[model samples]
Target: MVEQDSTFLLIIIALCLIFDYHAVLLPSAYNQTAISQENETRAESIEGTLIPSEVERFNMSSMDQDYIEDEMNYPPIRECSILEEFKECGTACEETCDDLRQLIICSQECVPGCFCKAGYTRETKGGCCIPTALCPLIKRSTVCGPNEEYRQCGTACPRTCNGIPEDCTQKCVDGCFCKEGFVLDLDKCIPESSCRVTEVCRENEVYRKCGSPCQEICGVQKETACTGCIEGCFCKLGYVTEEKAGICVKPEDCIPPKYVKCPGNETFTYCGSCEGSCQNQMVSCPTECGSPRCECLARNNYVRDKFGACIHISDCISK
Candidate 1:
């Protein structure tokens, strides 16, 4: 009976010791976690990552706490690898070539670390960052259009069949573009020889000094009439222009003739034969009303396109 009583007392004592041990450790652990959280909370600003408390300060005046004035010393910058600089607050997500294959959104919060300098990115984890031009281009099974290929730094303003001007102000960018001696046409790269800028116009299409966009057409209406005269091929005097295709054909060639009355841009005339298309236009022709039709005048800058359609004279191809 005594032995049993002693054993129960011993077990009670052991339980008390265990409770006291946990009670003593719980507060300590809680204080440590709270301090750590408080320190992290202090890192609100971007400039300084850590603000040292009195305990954290190494050397300080005893009587008066004059903190360490050295800014660089407080935020110790570790030695970084080549091509890296210490950023107080910067993105840690360095996109690698392999990483680009999948989409991974990175945290936007301030992350202090060594990052690659501008114009550089890592090809892989722990690898040095390099310029995109130097990076191995991701290969594609598909080929570019005819007379086109990918370039590291190609012109953003490619020359098209219309002979659009190159934008000198634009910086070089990467992409597929026409190779030398070729031009872009309808989004396809073709030999410059085949482009309309150099090719011969079809029959009845004379390379006139001026052309009119307000000329006749099968079916279409222009939003903005060609303001000034342009240089390009135009239809002869006998034929009018097909509005939609910009092709030129005889007045009788108009399909259905549903819109035979007049073009939206042109004013109908009671006297068709002498209405206009005159070199001097209205001034030369007197009003002697007769058959009705649409006509163009030189002052309006009317001319013909390659297909013999009337176009703005300014559209004429330059010699």
Candidate 2:
């Protein structure tokens, strides 16, 4: 009975080995052998023995278990995804809108896998491939007016009369830009020579191709401490700008800011000209350096009251 049982076990292992050698992956006709043929010589010698050694038996059992586990755990193969097709000889190089018009030399070697469909290219590197017509660079072509040229990818903030920004975040854009020797002015491309003529500088203002953004403004004096330059009309030397009015004036000519008014007689000032608090009535108090808010009325001969309102010097003294 023991000899018969051993023979039966050997037959079952041989059948498993034969099935493992001819196994195929699902959804495809590709052949993939599971076990190595080096073990075939060792398996052949075991057939002569009535009962195989424990090591030989363990090896056979492991080989059979590996084959069974592989078939049970094999993942289901899927068809091509959207905008992709199974090609027998797919190109190693991918197509994109940036280089779609350029010539590409692809290998004709067999590489059976999914690839982008006809008339479609990869949208971005390792991104969802989309239709060729939907590409923004394709649509932007020939959209420029005379003297202007279309760019597939260029600075969105083009060189204007004000000047191009140094730190331009929106650089990757496809649209009409001024051609060489041309500058954009009021949404129209004109000769570089006439760029300044279009941008007429006002009095006490000068047009700078590359000017500092930090300048003297009303109640705020500063020097250029910027990382980049700004192109536009800037206040000339010995001149300061009143930003709200969009005009330049001398430092002494800057009108005290009155755009903001407090309740009652109190007025707002960027450079607090008044230093009188409600508890301290100072009609002729010296202006101190600080972020002075609504406290007192400068040059109005008034002091702050307890209710945060400005009152005449005589009224506070009388109380």
Candidate 3:
């Protein structure tokens, strides 16, 4: 029994030692955890204060530098006083007119100048400003009519045929035109009898040029008023005349007009002939000459179709 009692006491003492050892280790672990937490808290506080201040200081310094650089680069502006008058000055124009000239300052010291008179522009062609209407017409080659009167190309010139006004649109060429009773044949003026009047007007046949006349015997009546005494032939609406063949054909049968190198930077495209209307797709040619010819109409790009009609890029897809 004594031996048993001694064994029990030893066991209890060993248990108590284990408990004391555990208790001692628990405080050390707790201190370590507290210390780590305190260090993390301190680090966070320092970062929050120091990092923001550093960034703020950097931004402030950059702004200051930029301000200093801008101040150094730009010159100080001086305010001019309204009352301060200089030695050099000129009389200001005080005229009130619709076509008034632009204000002119003779010198830096001068006050605001007077306005130009009505109908006058500020353009200085010679010495003084003049009315825009009074300005000389640009000296283009004068186109003379059958009456020896000046008329612009495409203008309807007056011609007396059978005591009636033959309304002829002038060509681009400038020279003395044919007389009243005569029509232009090729380059020369000739009598109407000398010109060939088509015996049978085609489906779209029409009279073109000065001396050209339509035979009354022909099935087609004159659709339009007689524009000229010339015997030049042209196709009517929706038909185009072949350039080389001089025969009226459908737009589908038209050969694409030959390209003529137009002078100057003026951009041109084929129009009027086999070329479809510059205005739209469905519109027909204005003249019988099916040959597409270069024409100046603003600026546009054109291509020929398989049917030989000149079409705008916006109207058709390019092959």
Candidate 4:
């Protein structure tokens, strides 16, 4: 009876050992192998964060409880292999609180809509959020800056620029007029030193020089002195006379003419003239007549000279 009892006890102990090995040890080993493979796959992705969608997929998979528990026991995987990466995933590390508060650095050419923390402005250089240290602050829903003029009369400002009155409000800076040397013709200020003098056609009839005044100048109607000559009959060349004649004449003719008696004819001489023919090329003088030629001059052949001489112009030409 003792020997039978010993054999039965030994059989029972061996069965218990086999059952424990298959149930616990084998499954544990398999779970470990699966978890190791999972970690290796996660390492191949770009970002260093686990994808939540991938975790969902993994939980939904038919993996056994032993494998799932083994996965949950380890630290969160650094990456995800099953799902695509989240675009707006926080750049900060969850392990550190400081990283959460700090804004992410960005490339110089980053586009708009990039992630930035609140209380920061998108820098002109990059889309990165920069502290609004120098930028205008919004107070009472108003934006005012150092250089810019502000008007806070109402919810919507009565006007935009501050310095000038509302009626004359424009984008003027400094004084209202153009800078020195420059005339205020255009909308913006320009260097007046470059401009030239005005073009004056006449004293009162001054017109801006061609391409000047930057606009039209004193019109013809403004010049009352140029009345008769308005249509255009200016004095002859080498002349200096006013436009009083209403007609232009030689500069010398501007004054009255003098009268003299025709030497031989005793006729008044307005201008030099001769009757038929006269000797000694008579010139009209009040008291007496004078002549250079002693012999009589031909009437037709020898025409009158400008000085009332009866000498032929043909003779003069021939001579």
Q: 1-319, model 1: which lDDT tens digit per residue?
A: 4355456445544543443233211121111111123235332222433445546555556433342243323433233444555577987677764554345788878886657777666645765555544453432212467788766566767887656542244665656789899988768888889965444667656553345756544333322556666667667665666654567776545443445655433544433444222133234555333355565543476643444345565555541
RMSD of 3: 39.7
Off by over 4 Å in 3: 1-117, 120-147, 152-182, 186-198, 207-235, 240-319
For model 2, residues 33-93, the per-residue Cα lDDT tens digits are: 1222333432212123322445655767777656544544646454454556667777677
- On lDDT, the leading prediction is 2
- TM-score on alpha carbons, each prediction: 0.29, 0.30, 0.21, 0.16
Model 4 residue 152 lDDT? 22
Most TM-score-accurate candidate: 2
lDDT of 3: 0.39
Overall local distance difference test of candidate 4: 0.32
Candidate 1 wrong stretches, greater than 4 Å: 1-87, 91-114, 117-120, 123-133, 136-143, 166-168, 197-319
Tens-place lDDT digits, model 3, residues 132-163: 44322211223444434322232234332222
Give the per-residue Cα lDDT of candidate 3 at 314.
Answer: 64
Q: Which ten residues in a row have the lowest lDDT in candidate 3?
A: 24-33
User: What's the lDDT for residue 4 in model 2?
Assistant: 52
Q: Let me know the TM-score candidate 1 reaches against the reference structure.
A: 0.29
Clashes of each: 32, 1, 18, 7
Every candidate's CA RMSD: 22.9, 21.6, 39.7, 35.3
Q: Please identify which of the two predictions, 2 or 3, would achieve the higher TM-score against the true structure.
A: 2
